[model samples]
Target: MSQPPENFAASIKDFESWPENLVHQTTCLGVLKAHKTRLDVTEPKLFTQEAEDINVSFLELIESGPTFDNLEVSDDEELQQRLGEASRRGEDPKCRFIFIGAGSPQAPLKISRKMLVRVLSYYQVIPGYVDRLLEFDGRGYARKDMYSGFLSQTLLNHTPTMEVDYLGRSGRQLQLCYNLRSIGRTKRNHLAPCHKQWSFRHGAFHHQFDILKGTAVWITTTADLDLKKRIEKSTGKTGMREDRQFQTPEQCLKSSLTVHLLLCDWAYENLRVYFLWLDGTVEDEMYLLVHNRRIHEEYPQIYSLGDLEALRNLQEQTKGALQVLKGNIGVFSGLRDFYHGLGENDGFSLRDSCIGDISSFTRQIDNIIDETKRYLAQGQLIAKIIDARETIIFQHFQSQATEKTEQLTTNMQRHSLTVRIIVFLISIYLPATFASTIFSIDVFKYQDQDPISTSNASDPIKQLVSIPAIALDRWLQVTLPMTCLTFAAAGLWLWREDRKLRREYQTTPICTN
Candidate 1:
């Protein structure tokens, strides 16, 4: 509905005028709406014959027990007292629904397992696919998809919903689809699915969703089991940390919806700000990529960018942030749909002037996702190029090392002849010295017989023209007793020295340095 500006405080100001049991509030934001409601002016009883068109099975449509064990209250006495006081007061609630905080006072409306059944009892006719919507049979984690998404039963009676693609502030509008579902006496009560729509762009004359103009019991946000925990955990209050303790249920619903709509507008504005920030960040990254050393379209950069690591991290964070935005889009989009869905469902005219803002937000969210994916792909390419260049450089160094090893092998081959010649000379000199010791022959005179020439393919060990290292017949006999006497003299000399040191008075310190 096109709701004009309202002084919400004034609407709820007649505190004493309101019914004493209008809302059953224990804490700040607890249960609201009486079990038995009646018309304020007519004073028609909802559960008794005093009520007009009362259903015989009225108990099935509303709560009627001494206590709400459905909610999580501990004390039996306290629970009974609360229920007893509410019943004795004789107040009636108009709305068929009850608002439960679910867990805490500040929490949003959350119907517990028992509360769910109570609400189900309220409706005489329900769709067959409600089980798919609730998923109450099983426990643990649940997935949000076809049945779990924000959109409820779009086609209530094979009728399409009222929706359109976003274009601008004043875009072409389409007809809305409306349907109503309620229960009364099968014989007397008769109601039709009211179908209504209007194009806000054209300013066509038509009625919209019912909220303020009397028929609406409660102007609810998205009421799905999926948001049960989320709403319960919502710590955000309506205003700047102010108290809303005195607000009636009606006031709370109206104020909360108004704030929720404003928040939708604010979210769209923030999206524009985020888009600008993203554009600047991307531009800076591109500038840095080109500034260090120009990147050509035709060729790839073989060398890695110095700040590539930092840039990749930034991109990763950006991608994560964008993912979070996408999730919010899904949630907030559902909320927006809930508001727009009102236009078609009720008799009151519901048309948001800034309905186009939600569509624009959706487009921007998609764009951010696409851009993030593209940047991640670019980062992968840069990483690949750097890896390829590293492989090339490594191969070049390996090739040079192999060439140096081959040169060392060639040098070893060239020195083989010189090494053999030195060994042969050592063999000749040893033989001459042995011959002189055994036969007492003058080596200076015998050495002139033949200069050893064993460099050719002749046996250097036993050649007739070359001298051997030792003569075959010559042998040295050991004088064993003389060698033993020499060892005994060395032992006696060491014993005499050790005795002299033991008698000395002074101890010398060893120098470490």
Candidate 2:
């Protein structure tokens, strides 16, 4: 057989809209549907037909009586009048309403603020026909385009009103605005920055939402029962007593059934009004399962960041913070008690946090200031030491440079004096050479050459040769020995002078001046 395309609209109409009456009783409200809802139907006959789809068995049980006892209001004449009118219109006053739901049990059930907020977001029912119901004409539910959180408007934009008997006060009506806005803001602030991460550090009930009942509600595990009870007491004193409580792990499981329930009952009342306005028959059409699944999957993740480990770690941090806060309270309490009992002067050491090591509250600030001054004094001392070391090193380098400069100057002066002495010796040798050349030029001319020399002179060539020989002999006699002696004396004198100068240098005092 061929199946028709899932015409979601047609398919949706086949099932009933959600059962609003069951909302208070179960974790879910069964789906329901009706064309002319009790609120929508002006005629009495149409209203009866519309409400027939609601659970017949449940309606029979209510009609049978005991359930009505819980709902009857003796003093609420207005509510009684509305009920009579509904009955006269042939509407089944037994429209299956909230009978049961996950409630606070004595067992341990530990729940995160995230989980509670998610649950609240899931049950956000839209009361579409409340304004038309006449007796409960709330202006917020009258708007045709009013959505729960779509189109940038929160439940706050559409203020909801509810009739309730608070404590001893009966028939009093209040808006869920203040509580809803507070919780919504808390959840929004807590989750707004979590898109960038996997875990968030926050206090317990950090993302709490009010259950239309006026207080914040938290469903917790059985293991934390004792702590939760104490927390409730604390909340009462802290002026947050409006927080309601609930239980998780509905069936019997033994991980420790201690649970904490935070009620946003005061604020959540507005949501209840919006939900109440909904025609019981159209429950299926305005079904919120998709919204429920989205909350279950996404809301927790807004704080958890997809990592189980991170989530646990954040939980642990929050728990630790809670413990620290508890300890602080205990300390403060002990201090108060001690002061009250002044006679017991056992001198309890008060450990102040500002000065970590100090145990006396009286001198805490003084100790901190003293420690700061000590640090500054030590820093200045170190700077002084560093400056002194640098000065010493600079003085040592100055002394070394002065000695090197003086040594180089002495070596240059010695080198210059040696060069001048060598030039002077060369000049003396130049004069001696000129004088020897002149003397050797034959002072007696040709007269000294006797017989053989005169005879050889007559023979022109022989005379020339004889004259040259005489000149050579004279030149050798005068110049050769004299040149040798001059050179020998120069060498001996230079050696002796160098030795004497070196000895004088060795004996002389080193010039400090």
Candidate 3:
């Protein structure tokens, strides 16, 4: 057997007064005890009990030793000889199985340093084993090296000396630590439990077993209470079942192995269900995107900015979930490989049937992962299509805008030509009209009475459009003051309008491009 450190007692003493913050507080404890019966009976009967104090119970077990009595003589001569030899050699022939489960499933169990030291001391486990157990926390994904079990140096040496002749038999001691993801149902409405909402939780536990002494201790945290109940119930049923046999401690250990297998099966089934849900969701999203694309093609204006934004959000959310699912697949693969290693390891004798079940789970999960990859690719394609279609719609609107601008420019140019022609005509007739009005003011006579005497009388055009003559002084006096006054008034109005425009421009807020 492996020995504890030389200062084991001192170490335990040091932990006795250790602060509470540094250790785990005590919680609920459950015990399963299996006592060996007659040699002829193939399996030992199991009993369940509860412990009020962890330290006291452990102390009792250590002091009292194996609970089964091996002194009674058997009827079979060969078996009796073996028993007698074992007794003479100071060995306990009768096997006793004791399983102590500590802590509830809702939270992780905290073992005080003192309690840890005590348990390790009683089991004669090496000090290095403490470091392994210390790493156990019931959260996070399991790494490749997370879920593992191994045979210690002492167990490897003791296995060859065992009297049993079974193939691939387990050693006297074994240590396994594992983490599993468990699924549970959540009631969106308490009145409607069948509404099909589900959540995921994790369970992590450490198992330490001494086969010869029939003692097993399990330390767990953040485990699923319901799953633990199921395990406990199943273990009880196996002990009570008539067909099953537990003739040796190895057989009992095998039953425990079955529990682990059952757990794996349960976890795998839940994960499969979860993946199917994800597949359906992603498929539905893809269909919706395809439908939207068709609508955009037929009636592009129907889709608004808000609609596109919502679709983009949905796509991102789905992508994130898929990424999480991929990670889960990786973690599940690690779990599968951990169990596969157990099946091959000589220390645990996990049957071929169990390994086969693991393989089946692997193949199914792999298929789901492949399908998930295809969905990811399809999602990316849809995103690109949306971007391309949006660009096309924007370009179409831009072209329409350009066509309207060109039309406006042509109309403005035509209007400007009309205005220029009107200005030219006015410029030519304005001087002549002003001069006619001044001379027609009775300041000069047309000489119509002596038309024949006038020189222009002979020319019909000149006689019809005659230029009247007026006194030079009167004409200058009449036009000069009016012209100067008109010019001065126009200048004053222009100056006032310019100042008004400047003020308005200063008050207006200028928008920058």
lDDT of each: 0.31, 0.30, 0.42
Query: Which regions of candidate 3 are displaced past 4 Å?
Result: 1-11, 14-155, 158-172, 183-185, 189-198, 238-247, 293-513
Compared with the true structure, what per-residue lDDT tens digits does model 3 show for residues 376-478?
4654555465455445444544555566668986996787567557645544455445655876687675445545548667888876566444344555666
lDDT of 1 by residue, 1-513 (tens): 222113212222323222222221222322122211122221211112221211111100112322112233323233234323323433212221122221211222233222222222211112221222222222211122212223232222211111111100011112121111111112222522111110000000011111221111221112122122322222124243221211233332343343343333332333434434444554565454443335454442333433445355444434433443444455455554554554345332223422343344445444544553454454444445444433444454455455666897688556755655664554445545554564555542233233445353267555555543343323322223334444465457546755665555246442221
Estimate TM-scores for all models.
0.28, 0.19, 0.41
User: Compared to the true structure, candidate 3 yields what TM-score?
Assistant: 0.41
Estimate the TM-score for candidate 2.
0.19
For each predicted model, how many residue pairs clash, with residues at least 3 apart or on different chains?
8, 74, 4
Model 3 residue 240 CA deviation in Å = 8.0
What root-mean-square deviation over C-alphas does model 2 reach?
30.9
Q: Of the candidates shown, which would achieve the greatest TM-score relative to the real structure?
A: 3
